[model samples]
Target: MSELKNSPWITCFLRPQELLLLLMLRWAIAYMEDPAFPHLGDSSQPLPRACPWRCSCPRDDTVDCAGLGLSVFPDNITKAARHLSLQNNQLQELPYNELSRLSGLRTLDLHSNLISSEGLPDEAFESLTQLEHFYVAHNKLSVAPQFLPPSLRVADLAANEVVEIFPLTFGEKPELRSVYLHDNRLNNTGLPPNTFLGSEAITTLSLSSNQLSYLPPSLPSSLERLHLQNNLISKVPRGALSLQTRLRELYLQHNQLTDSGLDATTFSKLSSLEYLDLSHNQLTTVPEGLPENLTILHLGRNCIRQVEAVRLHRARGLRYLLLQHNELGTSALPAGTLRPLRALHTLHLYGNRLERVPPALPRHLKALVMPHNRVAVLGERDLVSARALAELNLAYNRLASERVHPGAFRRLRALRSLDLAGNQLSRLPEGLPPSLRSLKLQRNQLRALEPELLAGLKKLRELSLAHNRLRVGDIEPGTWHELQALQVLDLSHNELSFVPPDLPEALEELHLQANRISHVGPEAFLSTPHLRALFLRANRLHMTSIAAEAFLGLVHLRVVDTAENPEQVLVQLPPKNKGALSPKG
Candidate 1:
């Protein structure tokens, strides 16, 4: 090949039509193969898009057409290049003999096309015994029999028309490890008991969003991950699921899994099950005899009123718990109920009937979502000690005071964001964490903001004080000066008569949707370097006041949401340009 590269006879021996045919074949082959534009060494600037035919290089071994939307598979592609991809196109069929000549081919991807099963080159793939990594997703395959590769390791046939599958469908491809059969028309009954008989070493099987009503009576024992979500499975067989003892992740969400019918003994055999999701069901209570090795458990959006912690206490390794929108009403959680969950990171208890905040929490609790509860007040005395808590969402609770305990959040050294929106706060609690970056305190009855109240939050970014009783007398420069990183400020839905010039640098994404902000000072955000995505949805300010240059410093500003009050934004971007921005308010 090196000697040929230096030969002028090599260029002389090749005909232009022969070169063109070989190049077109190579181009057809290369055009079908998807390759992300490469960067120079470690640099980030992507290479410009172009086909290899456009390159001045003398080599005719490579073709590239990654983003072109071509129709009809390129003809005689295999005679030149070994890899082929026609990604992001509307091609209907594969050109005849185009895939056969590429005996040296290793990959073929017809991703995002209209190639149905008939259009699929059924016999062509079996000939490429040297082929590996076949991806034909988002196509029209009605069954799993058309394409078969004995030396396959990964077969992604998702989002197809496969209606049924048989055990011999794989036909003893023992090396196959991953099979993606999700979003197909296959049902549980359509698969035979030994459907996974020969493929015993397969690990991941995704049948989610299919017609599977229950687990097949038998499955591969080496199965590690089984995704059966969004199906009509009402009952999991007792002996049917005992084979997959090594299964780690099991997704059963959006199914009609009833507590009365599911045999507890079936799940008892899965000793390695770590993740379990049983959300969005009609069960009144969970079945007993849960696995002891489970780690993550999700039982949200159900009719469960009572929780028996003793059954789950055996899972000493349980980490994350999600019990939202349940009826854990008024009942006291048993002592040491969640105490053993030492590895717990996130516990969601929102939309419950608990009238009192629990005084005990895990040592590793990071995110506590307890919004929309019946608790009327909150302070350090009621909140459990979670020094590592970073995001606390206690919005929409009935609180009337702002005198939270001085040490309420001082211990949370890592606390960065807090959402107290839709409360009845008259003032901010004392001693908030200084590391906070985002604060949401809208829809309250506070009369004004005390500039001295917030002097230590140096990392504050987005603060929404909308829907309050704010006034110009409440303004102070220290409040804005202390927030060195303030990007978005929402002071709308207040009684402000004059727009204050107190915002510091980097005040982008401001939301003054509804207020009496009659004037936006010329230097309102003079120092703001990256101000963008503003929302003055509603105010008494006129359109002319917001001259074309009124937003002069915001070179990065692209979207301004003013749709909530048409009279306010239309008074600004008049006539009919109001329909262009994202949904406002």
Candidate 2:
């Protein structure tokens, strides 16, 4: 070869075109003879300079084509793309070989489309060997798409029309960790035994809003969270969850679970369980054998009549317990039933038939809701142990003012809100906590308000005294002077003939609708400079009684409702301003 190159005949005798062809032939021969040459067939083509039309390439490896109303996938997408989002489009199909070039793709989102099972072929995702997360939710898929990548870790198929899921639908996907199949039509017959036996690595599985009538015993042992809410499941046989020892959360609300269907031994083996939701079921009593580490339990809207202390003794770590809308009565809860719940912080017992409050509440309890009951009395010992209580709701009950003990709420120094509306109270209860910020006393029979009734409520901000029999002399002078923080007061549906005097200067809203007030003067709102809303609707005011400048001092007053009074009375008030007054007829 050196001797041939040294001779000048080859270069001097050949034309330019022939010389180029000779060099190309020599290069090709050298590549064929040498085994160390790298393959350059795929990389020889230059990458596209710009992203596809109507799409954005924020990075060199990401493509966002969401919400484009596209009926077909874009052509010639860069094969180097690792993330592609085509959600909220009109595409209906994912045919085979359509994504063959995107073998390196790791995330693909096709949510909120019209794609069905038939639109996606068996090998639609065969080439995506490196895919990790796949989202196909909110579509029209009637069956599980086949040939999902083995490397997939998360698959979302929620809000679809999938009626059946075969045992091998997720064929041998050992790396799959989360599978969302909620809002489908899957029933017990469609889900055969061992449907999830192959998915050992699945930690979260959502099968909610289905027609399953029984709990499946084929759940994987490594599963940690399972959601089966809004299903028709009526039975949970013994040892149903024996294999799932690592389960931590189970949601079975809105089902047909009864006391007989739920065997206590089924959950004793799940030592790691922390949350359980069995609300809206048919059980007549609290379930037993709950895990000791449980932190939350929801059993609302059931037919449970009793909650025995033994049933909750093992769940010492429970912090939240909801038992509202049941058939429980005063005798249903025995004494010391809640004493073992040392960590309980929130308890909901509203909408029951109890005639008295439960005793021995946890000292650390923060929220206690017991409204819509038949309790007629509130004794001093009702809440003595709840020193840390911040919220207490006892509205819509049969409580009478004479029945409440004077020191019923004196121990609750941390109380901030107290609701006692829709009762038969004739007077204000004594010894109310001074830390109360909100007090609801509406729809009662109170006839007067003395100065001593609100003497220590310096932090009171809102007070509702509507729908009472209070008259002009009901409110004494300086009745609300101590409540410097008072901002809202509602005295509507009363018999008061005039605006009460000595209101707090910080008052922002005053409601006195359906009263007998027939006159108003300019000094009516002189003390309330920050008043923004004043309602005097359905009063007995005449057109000539109200002074034109009655609201002049209220610079912040914007909303005034004087309707249902005479139209002549409305014409006597001052002309409405653009930003100050918005009087309604």
Candidate 3:
């Protein structure tokens, strides 16, 4: 065997399956070289049980023969298999030690059977000293007994009828690292006062979805990750993680963390921490003094109001900062508030009470989100258009005028999409970057759209002018004579009284929702032979026939979003211009 393994010619001449078997045999020989686990031979057998399952096992260290309607454990199994799974059987009481003859057993999974918590004997698992993993989850255990292994590293007692953990139940397993005690009847107050008497050996812990409003004063310093999310955790011990210097990731999201619970020193000692998620909480005020090493901070869907991240200047590595849905007004961000975070790329300040625009924003920011705010003006010279800015979203603001400075976007040559929908604007602004591709101005107060406002956008492809007071007379030949690259045009939610003529030649998506359009005027969409994704949702149309030639006019019409139209609007199937429409249709 040794000569064959070292022979280079054997590797080149053997098939894949033959080579794999030889490699596995050689690997096992090298791994089991320990004097305690000797190899067996055909002539003179040694450690004969280890040869029974050298292969053909379902998973690593686990062998499942459960629900086979057997009366006793499979006696023909090998000793090398660490875990033996036999669940949902007809055993009333575990005949302890009958299966413990194999001293190499590491895990014993016996769940969903007729074994009750009261039926467990005192010395059930006391003999299995080498056992490090056990799974009794989803069983009929009501009261946990002191039956555990001293060398245990992980134990799953979850999804059981257990009421609480006794103080002495896990006291023997001082080396236990992970424990799953969730989804049980263990109340915070009903815990055995000394449940964590020797819990210092643990590194990763989870007590989520429980009745815990607070935690114990002391925790294991070796813990690197702790999850206390989705529970009644309203408060934690002062500087709860102060001693956990090695902690890298902590999940406390979806908890009731208020100002009192989160303070400046909450993460003062967590210098090694990297990822922290405190989103979906009732934090009314901004939590200050965050760990400087934090990379991704998710504070979205919380009650955080002001941009009062006092010491956030230290978070230089922050890439994504989400502060959506709060009482944050634009005034809260002082001049140069975000200028230091040059590395920041994505900023979500949506759904706030911002009154005016901000200045001196991060120059290298890629995404700028200020949607659903009370913004009336995107202040001039306030914050120079960052050339690196790609997406600008100011949707659902209170902007009424064309106050956006022209130079504000000249430097933003990377701007691809601009959303100014749900605002009070009557007309689009100028100085739109030449690189602009998409502009969303839906649900605005515009009565007319001047052609020159959009003629400068040479690369403009998608434009949404829905929910406006636009009239049919607002259309003309110069509407888009210069924009040869125009494609998707949304004119929905407007009081358009008439249908225009000869829309953009490349027009694809046309929206005319919530309008008073009565005339499907002549030459309408005649230039658009590649129109698609047309929407006529909610409108009053006086032109009922919508001539059969009307839809046959366009060649590439597809995906018409006219599902929710008002009673007055008429519907019709559009035409297709072979190869004239987009290939995506």
Q: Which numbered prediction scores highest in lDDT against the true structure?
A: 2
- List of clashing residue pairs for candidate 1: 31-85, 32-84, 32-85, 32-86, 33-84, 33-85, 487-508, 493-514, 513-538
lDDT of 1 by residue, 259-316 (tens): 8657667678889999989898766665566788888888888877766666666666
Best model number under TM-score: 2
Give candidate 2 regions above 4 Å deviation.
1-50, 541-545, 568-578
What CA root-mean-square deviation does each model show from the true structure? 11.1, 7.5, 11.7
Assess candidate 3 and give its TM-score to the true structure.
0.72
Pairs that clash in candidate 2:
none
* Model 3: ten consecutive residues of lowest lDDT: 576-585
Evaluate residue 30 in candidate 1 and report its C-alpha lDDT on the 0 to 100 scale: 52
On residues 143-241, what C-alpha lDDT tens digit does candidate 3 reach at each position? 776667678888877766676677666654688888776666655665654665676677777666666777645667777778777767777677667
Computed on alpha carbons, the lDDT of every model, listed in order, comes to: 0.71, 0.87, 0.70
Worst 10 residues of 2 by lDDT: 569-578
